[model samples]
Target: MMDDFLTVIALIISLNAVICLYRAAVGPTTQDRVLGVNIVGTKALVVVVLVTFIQTESFFLDVALVYALLLFVVTVAVSRYLEAEGWKEVA
Candidate 1:
């Protein structure tokens, strides 16, 4: 029963990530797109953590941590890049 619940939650989070993809692709502004991507990444991280609990795999938690770090670094880097002088015009 608990496994089924986790599965449903994971599926919901995955669907939300897909919806976020549309926002990331068709957002009116670059900032919106970036925020959408960040949201999707955060959803993915939640799914990964859920999977760890559902599958009873400790390694997945490690993967989630790494994924979280990568997501943070990339988001920060992209945000910094978007804030640059030349990118301001594009934004």
Candidate 2:
């Protein structure tokens, strides 16, 4: 019963990720695309955690944590670069 619920949740997350991919592909601006990518990463992280529970493997949780950290760092770096570039354009 619990496994079935987790499977459904994971499937929903995967569907949302696909929608995010669409947004990333044709987002109106760079910021929109970045936001989409960030959201997709978040969804991926959730899916990973769900998988950990479904499979009863603790190692996947660790992998999810590492992936979350990487996602955070990458999003910050990209946003900072975009901000600097935007400032340059304004100046």
Candidate 3:
């Protein structure tokens, strides 16, 4: 019973991730897109953890931890690039 409930919740989170992907694709500003991507990444991490529980596998948790770290790094790097004074877009 608990497993079924968790599976349902994971499905819901995956749906939200799809919505976040749309936001990332259509956001008017770089920050908005970055925020959307970050949200999607978080949702993905949640899904991974849920899978770890559902499947009784410990490896997915480790994967989730690594994914979280990568997500944080990417978000910080993008934010820094956006905030840099002299960054230029290449045509």
Candidate 4:
């Protein structure tokens, strides 16, 4: 019963991630796009953690931790790159 509940919650989080994907793709501003991507990554991390619980596996938790670190690095890199662009507008 708890497994079923976790599965349902994971599915809901996945759906939310998909919805955030649209914002990542269609956001009007670069900052908004970055935020959307970060949100999606966060949701994915949550799903991975949920899977770890559902499957009673310890490896998935490690994978989730690595993925979360990767997500943070990428988001910071992109945000810094954008910031360093210094008010330049893409034509």
Top lDDT hit: 3
Q: Please give the clash total of every predicted structure, in order.
A: 0, 0, 0, 0
The sequence of per-residue lDDT tens digits that candidate 2 reaches over residues 44-76 is 999999999999999999999999999999999
TM-score (C-alpha) between model 2 and the true structure: 0.89
lDDT of 4 by residue, 21-84 (tens): 9998988888889999999999999999999999999999999999999999999999888988
Strongest candidate by TM-score: 1
Model 1 agreement with the true structure over 1-91: per-residue lDDT tens digits: 9999999999998998999899999899988898999999999999999999999999999999999999999999999998888554443
Q: Give per-model CA RMSD.
A: 1.6, 3.1, 1.8, 1.5
Error of 2 at 6 (Å): 0.5
TM-score of each: 0.92, 0.89, 0.91, 0.91
Q: Model 3 over residues 1-91: C-alpha lDDT tens digits?
A: 9999999999999999998899899888878899999999999999999999999999999999999999999999999989999877532
Backbone clash pairs in model 4 (N, Cα, C under 3 Å; residues 3+ apart or in different chains), count: 0
Better of 3 and 4 by lDDT: 3
CA displacement after TM-score superposition, residue 50 of candidate 1 (Å): 0.5
Clashing pairs in model 1, backbone N/Cα/C closer than 3 A: none
Segments of candidate 4 deviating more than 4 angstroms? 86-88
TM-score for candidate 4: 0.91
Off by over 4 Å in 3: 88-91
How far residue 2's Cα lies from its native spot in candidate 2, in Å, is 1.0
The stretch of ten residues in a row with the least summed lDDT in candidate 1 is 82-91
After superposition of all CA atoms, the RMSD between model 3 and the true structure is 1.8
